[model samples]
Target: MNKLIFLLFFAVTSCTTFSRYSPHNKMESCVEGYYCIVNDSLHLKYETLGGFYFANNLKEYRKIKVKNKPKFKNIIFYGKSNILDTDYYLILNNEIYPKNFYFKETVINNKKITIALNSNTNGTYNKDFILNFRLPK
Candidate 1:
């Protein structure tokens, strides 16, 4: 009887915990070197980085190299010449995204770097949205 009660309790607890985690609703966003997740939805909206530079000019853009991970849906580059006013171009699955932004002239020793972007999603221009990027080795 004791064993039966314990099993019943365990089953109920396990089901409840498992139901909270959903693989189908995850949301992922990758900027620079950082990847952000919302839930389980895979479609991530990307934004361009304005005024981002390496040395004297903007850092050139590059292809995303993700290993042991799912393929990205889109990539874009917003040139610094426009700076805070330029919009990013969408790079679709079949198309290649160009690396036109300038990187700091200094040698990048890290494998990844995170960058934050201004958030206008709320229509009030809140400064909370951050875009993270992963730099290549």
Candidate 2:
């Protein structure tokens, strides 16, 4: 009976589960201007930007300006290649912003990408946020 109880406790307490979006491995290297986070055993890597550009069409890239320079734009992206259908959040001024912005994925590599938010607003840019990523257990 004691052994059974111990086994049950071990199974319940020793089992570790990772977050839904956790990375497969720990973030070995982070960019100079970036930070990482682990939530529920998931790695979330992100960075903050003052402003960015967006192209209306994916085939043709065009630069559009915005009026209100975002106080800060939080970017959360994947660290691995062949990632599909990943959900990330972009926070601006501590508030969740819309997802109408455009993103450009690098064809040569899957390391990084540029996102343009609020193409209609124009002003000074200020970035203040650490990019975080979740790591798999």
Best by TM-score: 2
Model 1 lDDT tens row, 30-131? 456333333223233323232332111111333221131211222222212233432222222213222532121111232121222222222222223222
Q: Count the backbone clashes (under 3 Å) in each candidate.
A: 28, 18
Q: Count residue pairs with overlapping backbones in model 2.
A: 18
Instruction: Report how far off residue 105 is in candidate 2 (Å).
Output: 21
So what's the TM-score on candidate 2?
Answer: 0.23
Q: lDDT of each structure?
A: 0.28, 0.30
lDDT for model 1, on a 0 to 1 scale? Answer: 0.28
Instruction: Give per-residue CA lDDT, model 2, range 5-100, as digits (tens).
Output: 999999976642222233332332244543333322222333333122212121112123234223223332222111221122332122333565
